[model samples]
Target: MEDPIFSPPLHRQRHQFVIDFIKRNKPQKVLDLGCSECTLLKQLRFHREMELLVGLDIDGATLKKKMHGLAPMSTDYLQPSDDQLRIELYQGSVTQRDARLRGFDLVTSIELIEHLTLADVERFSEVVFGYMAPVAVIVSTPNFEFNILFPGKTGFRHYDHKFEWSRAEFKSWALKVCLDYGYEVEFTGVGEPPPGQQESVGFCSQIGVFHRLGGRAVCNMMFCDDAEDEFSYTLLYSKNYPSLHDNNILQRVLVTEVLSGAEKLRRKWAEETNGERDAADTQAEGDWEERHRASEQHLEMEEKQTDVFLLVEIPSSEVEISVNQMDCKTLQQAEQQRGFWRSIRKLRKKICFGLMAEDNRSLGKCVSVPLAVLWSGCPKVRALGGSLSNLRQLLMDHPGVTLSQDGSAVLLNDQEHEEEYDDLEDSGYAEARQCSHSVEPEEDWDANV
Candidate 1:
């Protein structure tokens, strides 16, 4: 039976190209670089004519699960297949040349080079050409210049791709590698270009085939003592930070101190304001009752007098005293009303303080105290009225007030106090200073004031 007709899709084209090349050359042994999960290797396995098929990858677990009946072997112990067709899986890095990689008839790395960092590309070139020195090498990569043809494609084909090369750039690098390694090279496209194009601008994918001129291989291929160190593992794109135990402790201490100070200031202000109101109320009530008793005695004297003139005079003074007492009583009631409102305001402030304290506790878990303080404009502390100025001064005089290497405030331990922090400069401090000016006591205090 003849081979099935494969579609001309970009991905299918790549596999077809490699299959055709393999069928024509009929290499005895073949190596596949970055053979993850053996997707392409499984396709290649259909051809039983090849005596040896070696799949190399960094992930041993993946190869074990994917490549059936292919036992894992140490890089040093890898041997070419003696049977009619044998598949071998070697867990290793292509960037590092191993002696086992030598004497291959063909080497194929499909869409692998773009995943490597620029620094690793040089090592990869040396390993494939200067070291393995296969009879033929085939490589494929995405054409970045042709990416515009696809709708809504923003960046590289894959997030893991460190860099993508244009057709011209790929040709330039491929030609240089062939020239340096004494190989004749050819380039081809895997996808059709846009319609109405007279010349070949580029392709969605680019392929290169390199044929060694004399099949002369270099020795040892830059022997690496740590050649066993694999580069085939997944790259972690996100940053990792050490646990924030120390920072958490520092934040807790700072928050505790701030809360304590704020409570004290609130208590002091409340006591002073309440005491004045209480004293005024006591004085007004006492004076009003005394005048009422005096008015009663005057009325009694007026009732005992027989002359109407004396009665009228005494009643007038009594009436005047009664009015004065009424005014004092009204003043006392006003003071009581003010006290009630003051208590209400204080209650609101207490509630706000509790909420702010909870916020501080949560903020401590994620950020250092000084950075949080600066970021939030010290809202909780500022809500302490006149105490805000004192807190600002305290922070300024604090020995631990230093900026981190990243310019955020660093909550230093006591031992780190003597260390110089001249390298730490924060432009944010200026913005923080401006923000602090706008930080007034919370609006709850307006009712009391």
Candidate 2:
């Protein structure tokens, strides 16, 4: 097995290039071909929104162990927990094994293709390109000519490898494959081809970026002889990607990569921290007020929203608010929702409301309204919007407040409360509104997952 840990400086350069390339594609479901120990996937996993991450390797036992350790870290793109990003690993050879994988946004074969025979390469490409999700396929192999740079560091080309191609040979083969499969191919360098002849510049390990056309395979066959004959080469596969917003491809790629990476890190950290947390530990940790303030600060930092509209139905209420189309309170409730925190879109300000009244007893059964709406008179007092007899009494003595029941709902129609919220937002006090009380210990952490 090749030691990725000791990867030569050149190989590391190639690996980084591939990582950046994949990040550009923004794949949802990723198939990691010839995944050894899955370190690359683990690192890359945190930088993107992943749906299903499947790792394939010939070593079943190692793959199993890796998967077990990762299972608890897996989560929905919106609610990734440490345990939910568990990668599914399969043991099988690329040539002899069938992944039955289709619709993958990206397929990667890093330093794995060099070990195959001509027949094996054909089979490997067929399966990879056939099932690829029209977005991108990245295949990297040792640049045979550049092996001169490392005297004793030739790849797995002993008796196991049928043949290895120079950069030009690999590019030629790639071109033929792309032509037959209908994929557009681009070449990327791994490690700089040590300063040498002009042609040697492209002589490092060859990375073929295969872009599937409309989800269809393009190339049928690429001959080694043909690759040897071609002269012109292009960097079509240079790292670039489309953005939902207008920006240069490189800028969008960087921004998206950072955003996804940050999210993945938070999820990974949360998973690690959440697993070991205990009631006593949390109780004994930091000052309650300070931690609460920190949590609120964290929340505010994440308050920036995406353009996409999210509809969240309050657990007990029939009302579902479109975070983009809601009142401030609804937006606040949306903010408190778990998914809302993970998404970084600017929410549209339209909120949808629904009223649920099963009977007189269930009038104010909603749990989200109280915390979302502030009572003006008492900064601490929040109206849950129900005419509970107990609440009515609390407000009656607390003049300048009205808990008047309107139909089946009790409106915490306090002018002072509204005024304060207005003032808070207008004067930019909202950002300064530090939580006055300690955030309750997350009693629901272990209970939720």
Candidate 3:
């Protein structure tokens, strides 16, 4: 099906122009002002040029809903890359001064200025230019002069438009903005003109590109919000979900291996107990019954099992970390939990091994290392700093045991317990890896069929 976001050729044309402009400029950081429904921002998500994307809007509810709806799909095409593009959404007015909005390379406001009052327009220009101080800014608005071409059009194009400006009005405002903010401005138009009308005077929309004057070309700032209250702004989605067929296969294999191993161990212990009982019966007739009871108790104790719980923190959104508790009874159970972590690892490129501790004052204490030190998995990772030295040491001690090239399965080596796991290696264990990564969609894209 055609993407509903790209319908209506006017908006699509505007979005394409902005996207093309960004591609040419190759901005590392991009800010989308008044990102309603995130239609343009969604298209920009696929672009590899942007390292960080920030979308701000005054309608907090709409922004939240749109972000949630546009959450990444479970496709390999959307898999996280080495550079790891980060997308963030914020609920706030563009006319206001926000420290979070500062330090962007390019800021885009598409069909947004017409909704604002003239006073808000001046404030928006000041905040974007004087405070945020991006190297480049692109703004687009409806050209009232072109409205005459529409046969029945009367007043404003839309009910929400505070005002629309003619080409001359837009150019005059843009030039004054450039003069005030020490920026060089360029003018452009979108849409076809009437047969008799000049292209400049009859286009449907007007665009202005503002280039900042001499200063530092780049600046770095923390784009992720860490405050507990800021979690509402983050967008999260899970990918690489396991299918029912795959889950059924995995269940059958694990059950067969576990039951078989348990039965073998039980029989071996029973045989050893029988030999001892026979010897006791011959040596002492009175103690035979006592020894038999002790053997039965030992077997019963071996049958009982305890569950293990592990607290793991997974990267969820740009600004939030998802903490999950993994519950398992046996080694196989623990291994089953690897699928979730593997997906996260693939998206992030390198998985950071961290020490998770329970704390009374806070939610939990997590000491995580940087990605560079994490991938190397060396003892020198401790020197990088933070209270994560213990985690680095643990990783250094076990090399290539937990994390693998495919990041699907973890191998445990225990010489004493080799016999117990002999069946596991042969019982279709590698099949679990297949379920961890992207799988072909069950449905075909051919709508006609």
lDDT of each: 0.58, 0.49, 0.58
Candidate 1 lDDT over 221-319, as tens digits, reads 334335453234332111111111233333334444554443444445547865765665455446654764664566455554322111112111211
Q: Which sections of candidate 3 miss by over 4 Å?
A: 1-8, 76-79, 218-449
Instruction: Supply every candidate's count of residue pairs whose N, Cα or C atoms clash at under 3 angstroms.
Output: 0, 39, 0
> The CA-based lDDT of model 3 is what?
0.58
What ranges in model 2 sit over 4 Å off?
1-11, 73-86, 96-100, 131-134, 152-160, 196-198, 201-203, 215-449
- Deviation in angstroms for 73 in model 3? 3.0
Q: Which portions of model 1 show Cα errors greater than 4 Å? A: 1-8, 69-83, 198-200, 216-449
lDDT of 1 at 23: 88
lDDT of 3 at 246: 45
State the TM-score for model 1. Answer: 0.44
For each candidate in turn, the TM-score is 0.44, 0.45, 0.50
